[model samples]
Target chain A: SQKIEQNSEALNIQEGKTATLTCNYTNYSPAYLQWYRQDPGRGPVFLLLIRENEKEKRKERLKVTFDTTLKQSLFHITASQPADSATYLCAPGAHGNNRLAFGKGNQVVVIP
Target chain B: EPEVTQTPSHQVTQMGQEVILRCVPISNHLYFYWYRQILGQKVEFLVSFYNNEISEKSEIFDDQFSVERPDGSNFTLKIRSTKLEDSAMYFCASSEAVDYGYTFGSGTRLTVV
Candidate 1:
């Protein structure tokens, strides 16, 4: 069975600091990985998608690193603000596979 | 930016009753999907629809479940006999291609009482 894991504990970060989160998977090699931000009572909003061949991807103040060898991916939010607080989810899937397996997600709280 | 839209933000239903959740995917998108999230759990895939037929479905999508693109634009998920365990937030998503990032709808919160 494929499994995806993330930190169960919520990350409390000071505003303007960088917040980092990790997502680890087992028993699968996905061709692409996606990160999403989900606010309470709302559906997930797609943030970034990185392929296995890409070591790093950046968008504005967000950065994501994919290390297929370690079966891990790191997500970073630089200069975080209070509005940046939300639960972040990571989903990984194969090229032909239509469904994406999502992790439970890691919550981030940016304190002012 | 195109967005997938789902109707009936929340619905409370009795057990053993039938319920149909509806969605209107992006016009230009060819692939549509149904996913659900139970309370605090991960989003689970229910089924995928393309060209007016089901392409793939999960075990969770048993005989009790059925999907349809009735009028070419509206996609629907029908539960024959809803069970208490069927309560979850059902989301509709669409993508231009299988590998593309999907745009998800706000979701319909179904509560089987």
Candidate 2:
């Protein structure tokens, strides 16, 4: 079965530290991968997107890397603050259409 | 910034009843989508709409599920017979172009009883 996986455990990091999360997929290659920040009881907010051909993408304090060969994408939050605490979701899409397959998000808790 | 708006932030429906969820996507966005997330589960794509018809839909969008852009501004998802498994947070999202990041509505929590 096609699957996208993220570490189920919550990442506990200190303020000002860099928190990293990983997403791995199997059985298919995605044309692009996207990251989203979701607060409890709220919709997921767009964070960043990286294409299969691109090595990395950055936006403010966030960075994303896509490695098609490895079928993995890494998301990093730099200078993490308490406000950065939320669940991060990884969504990867195929070559056609607008459908996105999402992984169960990884939670990050930035301690003040 | 523009937003995708959804109505009735929360709803409780009787099992076997019909329900319609409404949404107003960003005015300029060309692609509209519906996604749902069960409690503690990943967000799942239900259907995508473009040019007044469904562009693509997941298997979860069965005979009981249907989508329509009834007018210029409103898009709706109608489930003919709601089931317990249908209870989830239904989100409406829109994107200006293909592959663009989607702007999602806060979501409607549909609870089936």
Candidate 3:
């Protein structure tokens, strides 16, 4: 079975510092991986997508890198702010399917 | 910007009663999906719909469950018999196309007492 694992613990960082989160999977290599941010009592919102063939993807302050060789992906928030605090989820898309298997997610807190 | 929306931000129902969770997808999106998150758990996919028909469903979605795009803009999930275990946050999502990131709604919190 495919299993995705994130830090599964809360991460605290001082504002203006870089925060890094990890996602690792076993048993399968997916076609694409996605990251989402979820706030308390609200539905998750899509943040970024990194494809297997791509080494890295970036959106303003967010940067994601996919290392298929390691079966892992790292999410980074640069110059982070308190507004960046939320639970981050990692979902892996089956090699050629739409079904997504998500990790337990990591809670990030950027202290102001 | 277009976003998905769900009804009854919160619902409390008695066990054994039926409940309908509704959603409205992005105007032009073809793929729609339903996912649930039990308290303190990861989100779980329940079903996916397209072309007014179900394309896929997970084991969690059993005979007691049904989905309908009853009109051009509305999509719904009907639970034939709500169980206490059915208590969870039900999220509705849609994607313009498959393989794209899905936009989810502020889920409906269903509590079966």
CA lDDT scores, all candidates in order: 0.93, 0.93, 0.92
Among all candidates shown, the one with the greatest DockQ: 2
- Summarize candidate 2's per-residue lDDT along A58-110 as a digit string, tens digits: 99999999998899999999999999999999998877667877899999999
**Model 3, span A1-112: residue lDDT tens:** 7789999779999999999999999997788999999998898999998898999999999999999999999999999999999999999886536566678899999999
In model 1, which runs have C-alpha deviations exceeding 4 angstroms? none
Clashing pairs in 3: none
Clash counts per candidate, in order, are 0, 0, 0
Tens digits of per-residue lDDT, candidate 3, B1-113, equal: 89898998999999999999999989999889999999999999999898888888999999999999999999999999999999999999998777789899999999999
Reference contacts preserved by each model: 0.67, 0.75, 0.54
For candidate 2, give the lDDT. Answer: 0.93
Per-residue CA lDDT of model 2 for B25-47, tens digit only, reads: 99999999999999988899999
Q: A8-84 in candidate 1: lDDT tens per residue?
A: 99999999999999999999899999999989888888999999999999999999999999999999999999999
- For every prediction, compared with the true complex, DockQ reads 0.77, 0.80, 0.68
- Chain A TM-scores, candidates in order: 0.99, 0.97, 0.96
